[model samples]
Target: MSDLVDQLVAGALDRVTAWPDGALARSSPPPRSVLPGSFNPLHDGHLNLARVAEEMTGATVAFEISVTNVDKPPLAVGDVRTRLAQFAGRARVELTRAPTFVEKSRLLPGVTFVVGADTAERLVAARYYGDEARMIAALRDMADRGCRFLVAVRADGAGRVRSLADVAIPQGFARLFTPIPESRFRTDASSSAIRAGRRAAP
Candidate 1:
């Protein structure tokens, strides 16, 4: 099983792989919508967000886990299996090498990416891409691929709840983002906090 898992992760590094609920793995077509996350433990917050996203978009939401990372090392086989286990019997998932939305857009064009407010904030922040011009170019590339974002509410570092409205989207890219009203869904559960709690446990 571990050897198979290793192969799956290796293949995903080259192209997207789809794991359907209670089914086998295969190549992925462009999903209508995707909720990409690290899913360290696949908590309720993620499930609720996907539920709301599906209801709003009228499309089945597939979960995505990128084995590659921009700031950290790629996930090891054991780590990938642990995260993939949480989705078993619950949701379909896609494994890919895309570490950024721009890369993901190119792989799965015309898909709506379900994201939290914090992610949407970073998407438009010039610092993330080195400069405003680079940021704009990346966004233009995503838009050109017909990618859009569905932003959900999330609490910022200051404990203030933020939605898409709080994000400073660049002028021309406004249409690429849509907000999931706080009335529809909200969750305080965070994977970082969960991991911290586990580490603190005696």
Candidate 2:
């Protein structure tokens, strides 16, 4: 592992359990914008979005895979390897234990998280934070930590789509999120569809 991954992993181990192995770890500094996802079946859409995000943020774009998911089982070594292999020489990847954006912000400060429309909706949703007050508090903490979000629009399969502008973000925290115009990037490529056997194997 390179120093960058080594440093990230060492810091994360202090609070979370993780398993990572591959060439995705690099000696260079981690990216300010991280695109976190399951990457169940890596595809061109993922690469396209990362490329666009890097161009906009001028930060090294990293593909982050959280070993610990909120509703899914922890990823095993095999699962991590299979996914990392998909990256090849395309991008830098990281392993983390953070399952939610709030935790991810606390774990890595001064980061601009690039997420899809769905993830952004969930972030501001009260159910995820237990209540509106808790959600507001989390957003406040995230902003203080220099964490922000770049939300990409996502298609809802019913021929409808939602972008960052569509979601009602927390008051006073609106400055923390940036929206990617649909004209620049839009895709219906979702991991859920791939898992449902709708997408072909790469």
Candidate 3:
């Protein structure tokens, strides 16, 4: 367990501060639907997926923020609160110290994570963990914890798009993921892309 996770999970009261429909929520058991991201600025692309994910799985939907970003500085509590406010009656949100999917599975056991094909692809890749054995071990751990994944299509460069089927998941872990067809949930809108466009605009 990491320092932040220890502080947040110590009291048996919370997995971290949570907000459901703009109101503070009690620390919960395994989450139903979890869309994990930085969510620097929540956008419609996220909302579209969340709505669809909830409908498809018939599970509660919530956005999850990892204060311990992979590269950036940890986010302030106020910043996290401000972002959660944006959901405002639209959805629930969670704040956590877990950065990678492996960590998230431990924190949000039995969760059905919503991810794009790009992210799902990375899950089986070795570079992310620097070795294939470690990656497989981590994924197996998630499965053992009863966590699963929902993957959607995403636009690649040159306007090309890839679907869940496009990702070559490992054989043993294939059952742990569900694919949403492109027709069902495809989106080119991304926060990073949006920021880049704004930066380039005159």
TM-score of each: 0.92, 0.84, 0.87
Runs off by more than 4 Å, candidate 1: 1-5, 11-13, 20-26
lDDT of 1 by residue, 32-138 (tens): 99999999988999999999999999999999888889999889878987888888877788777889999899888999999999999999999999999999999
Order the candidate numbers by lDDT, best to worst. Answer: 1, 3, 2
Model 3 lDDT tens row, 1-202: 4343345434333356455544454456656889988776788888889889988999878889876768787766567667767877676677777889998898888999999988998988988998988988998999999999999999976787877788888879999999987777888988888878888999
TM-score of model 1 vs. true structure:
0.92
lDDT of 2 by residue, 1-202 (tens): 5343344444435132122234332333445888889898888788889888988999867777877789987776667668777877667676777888888887667889988888888889999889999999999988998999998989877868999988988788889889988988999987778788764665
Candidate number with greatest TM-score: 1
Report every candidate's CA lDDT.
0.87, 0.77, 0.80
User: Please, what's the RMSD in Å of model 1?
Assistant: 2.0
Model 3 ranges with Cα > 4 A deviation? 1-14, 199-202
For every candidate structure, what is the RMSD over all alpha carbons to the true structure, in angstroms?
2.0, 4.4, 3.9
CA displacement after TM-score superposition, residue 198 of candidate 2 (Å): 6.4
Better of 1 and 3 by lDDT: 1
Residue-level error in angstroms, candidate 2, position 178:
0.5
